[model samples]
Target: MKKTLLALLCAFITSAASAQSVSTVVHPEWSKNAAIYEANIRQYSPEGSFKKFEEYLPELKKMGVGVIWIMPINPIGKVNRKGTLGSYYAVADYTAVNPEFGTPEDFHHLVNAIHAQGMKVIIDWVANHTAWDHPWAKTHPEYYIHDAKGNFVPPVPDWADVIKLDYGNAQLRSEMINALKYWISNYDLDGFRCDVAAMVPTDFWNDARTQLDQIKPVFMLAEATERDLQEHAFDMTYGWQFKDVWGDIAKGKKNAADLVAYLHGEEAGYNPNSYRMLHTSNHDLNSWEGTEFDRLGDAVETFLVLSNTLKGMPLLYQGQEAGNTKALDFFERDPIIWKDHPYRALYTKLFHLKQTNHALWNGLAGGQPQLIKTADDDHIFAFSRSKDNDQIIGIFNLSDKARKFSSNDPILQGSFTDPLTGQSGQSASAPIELKAWEYRLLVK
Candidate 1:
């Protein structure tokens, strides 16, 4: 009996390993050193048409962006809508383009334009729920969850514009997966950024990912941070905790020591190959919470450096380059004001650095960061990453007062060039002086 049980366990382990191998092989090769940018279609411009957005592709490409994550392009439901322009998450038709955005052909052209500029396009997909007016709610009520009175209900009380999808029904799962395939077959989309991904069944995502790859090797990004999602479903998960840490530091609630502790915990907890999408601001944080300016305060630029140089893929939200100052309205037509800004140069330089610096690349493609001992460990954060001979040392003063930090760590004492300033020099062995919230990246 013991031998029989052991044999069964061995068989199960082998089967699981094979399944993981298949999923691991499906990651697109192009994503190895990629950085993602969130494109808010509704507020990309005053017009918000695909045709107009296509014109901005070249500039984005110039900024060294590799992936363009377009917000939900599906038509928004009108039933119990919230504002003059409803929320983009209330998806009415999975296969149809929002008339407010443009015709299907226009989106196709935009995708083509994005590809022409050597950037990949990923559409925001809300598979957990749909707008109240979605046909499935009326024609196939069994595909939705119902209240005690047998009346269809929203997933949560706050999200009144949409209704929850019932993945328990086999037919509903098949239909949702088919809708996913429709985008790949019709528009040749690269992949999806699943909204509220953790709320859906993991099995559904695993199945959907399997089918999606059959059409094309797609890159999937989950809005959630569950490590299990990386087993076979998503290439990247949101770095929410990291963002929270940044906010805490900005508010003087945490310091460099806290960040070092957090990094150690993350390294020990998550799978080494799992890619975390790091960012200072995203759509949800910008709309629901506040702009980076409001939350990050004086530490905004300092946090941006950490987001881009850290061991993960970084995200650039729409209007962030222009230093977007306001929280974009969630349910209304609010356009981003564009202008020449230093933030643009900062991001462009960092994006370029991310591409060339193997030590800063994503996932297993890059080297893991090793913390370097400094003069002030509590208020000064310092780390070094090296892949082969390529090396980068980053030091940031995470305090409200100017400070001098000295470190004898050989990994940091070397010849280096400033990617930001184009200055070249050797370390003077003197204490490094820095202003509050200042950072220095020394690359060799």
Candidate 2:
């Protein structure tokens, strides 16, 4: 969580530019209620071509996904490459398309296909640094920060393969903002999934959000968790703290009591309008850590439902639906060996259910989750929500055995069928039954 030096410098620059930068004039509301899906292009298919990938838009739409966040499509920098393929974050050109992915026209076709499917696409944007081979490294030497020895360096200790951008120069900030606007203007992109967003100055994000809003409606997502970042900037930020809690519980270091505190603690930090993005796995977990099996294991399904049914937007990574069990190489051409499983069926029901139920909507539009008292508080976590007659109630057995629990909360109002089982859930007179690592979604 170390702050990248560039992030600090951009704060000073944003203050100076605020007087000249355009004020908040253009903004959209639809993004506030959208759910995001990360698309891993390199391993999406055996061929992994843009045209072939476009065909999945209909399938995604059927899953009720609203936003598609594509990983970096720009040309990768070759200098100091990591493996057969370098990190996508190492960008040689901000504007050019990587030939491996396909030509710009092919990407535009994919984008158009996404729009046609009624979903918006946001490309991953690496604003803190560029690949060492970037043209800016040679054209504008002053655009980069110098180390103690007067040499351009990577922003982080281990990121030696790239060069950090200098936000101290007002012109450099302009160049970065222009690059961001270019994507929105040319391809009609909804916004960006900023990489290592916490490493970039909050001010830079505030400014770029302002500029991009001028071009089109944008949804800004940061790969961070702090509330300060959401108070006035990003529409959504990563719920890494929540992720850590689930990881801890799975590892036997924590319990249901910890999860209650985490939910309440994060809610206090975030602003009324901003949201947190919850996910079970992404490119990071796929590459560095093991699969969900390696991380969450048996509780994977339990937590997956929690992520979708809880507050904020829920995300599903590319291979997660298929229950992929491989550790995808971050710096190589590793493709997922997909196999059919119950995960797809489980997630499909939850995804579609999320969109139709008003009590499960995003932001203030959705009802708050009030915890349901249970005799087994250590292992069973239960919560319910009610908006008028519509209600959403969930019960999860987080332990290795069954848990019988009951709640007096009226959010559990009315008798209805459980969405997961198509059977009766807990009624006011009757308690619910939960198997080990099982979760039930009740709607009335």
Candidate 3:
């Protein structure tokens, strides 16, 4: 009887532990079919103010953007600031809005306006570090890491504008959590996009998430790609690997098989419910690297389609829709040159399909990509994701040369129409011919 009771107790303990591990965080319902847009408020318009940026909310909503991830709006550090206008990541204050952007009241109205448009807003949070001038350096010196000489140090050598924050201090953790809570409580923000999230202790984020959720369900996006971050803290992480592989394919180094392998690897590595943010270009990529047009060449639209339909949430950076060729200045006000570009229409079609089609929904709410066998698997990539009555089939010609391919996969047999072009009557009976850097997104 003693032996049996001991065995039962151990099993019960193990089961409880498993349940606790799996139930760390619950995602917000609105995020399931949402496509996130990174709004560079400072560079969004000529004025680069909240009032100016707010004028385009209707256009964004119509463009099918579900969530708006605003870049840092806090006052930038001036002591060791970079360029005339310092980097957005070098934050001096956590709670106050940057006067350059607008008054705190203006920001409040902007957030309310975004919510009113049936969309969500999240602010970029630089948790790992702060500007050298941040008050914490004087009042709460213990909150930061110190050098042997007792001077403050930057997290990275090149990041001289900011000082590294130390999560080892319990008081610092509590204070940071309080600051995070302040935004949600006051502004009613949907969530935060934590910058360099992995640099901060995972336990700190876990605690933060728990406390934030107590206020309201929030969507957390981590800039890092660490898988463990998703298990507890973040709802989504950057799909840097996918972006790299896509770039390689465009450069003629990696092919379709390599792309498929990366997708398979992602499936095995991340939980089905974990959201990966896939994008062709972002603030960093566009500024540091070249524009998507420069890197992907003519294949920019082709990769954009894959990023939208593949098993993850899609991210659209500001200016991408306008086919903005110039990499806007990161530290200065370089407004996007908006024009009636064709990419805008393409993005609208893809984003709307993602919202309506259950197959392309984000995380576990959506179906997984099943590879559809094609004759030219090397140069052509084809796959289908279906949920209930909704289905989307994506076929891409990854090479610079046109390719002809045929697929006998049962999923490809049904009649389908191209969502972007509205052309119908495409079927698996005839071979498909695609031009170089062209893609066909068929929906049924």
* TM-score against truth, every candidate: 0.93, 0.91, 0.94
| Each model's total of backbone clashes | 0, 1, 0
**Could you give me the TM-score of model 3 versus the true structure?**
0.94
Q: 367-424 in candidate 2: lDDT tens per residue?
A: 7777886777788898876655567878888877777766665556567777877787
* Model 3 lDDT on a 0 to 1 scale: 0.90
Per-residue alpha-carbon lDDT of candidate 1 for residues 208-300, written as tens digits (9 for 90 to 100): 999999999999999998878888999998999999888999999999988876775543455667788999999999998999999999999
The candidate 3 region of ten consecutive residues with least summed lDDT is 15-24
lDDT of 1 at 313: 92
Question: Alpha-carbon error at 345 in model 1, in Å?
Answer: 0.8
Candidate 3 pairs with clashing backbones: none
Pairs in steric clash, model 1:
none
lDDT of 3 by residue, 287-315 (tens): 99989999999789889988999999999
Q: What lDDT would candidate 1 get against the real structure?
A: 0.88
Better of 1 and 2 by lDDT: 1
Can you tell me which runs of candidate 3 are displaced by over 4 Å? 1-24
TM-score, cand. 2 vs. native = 0.91
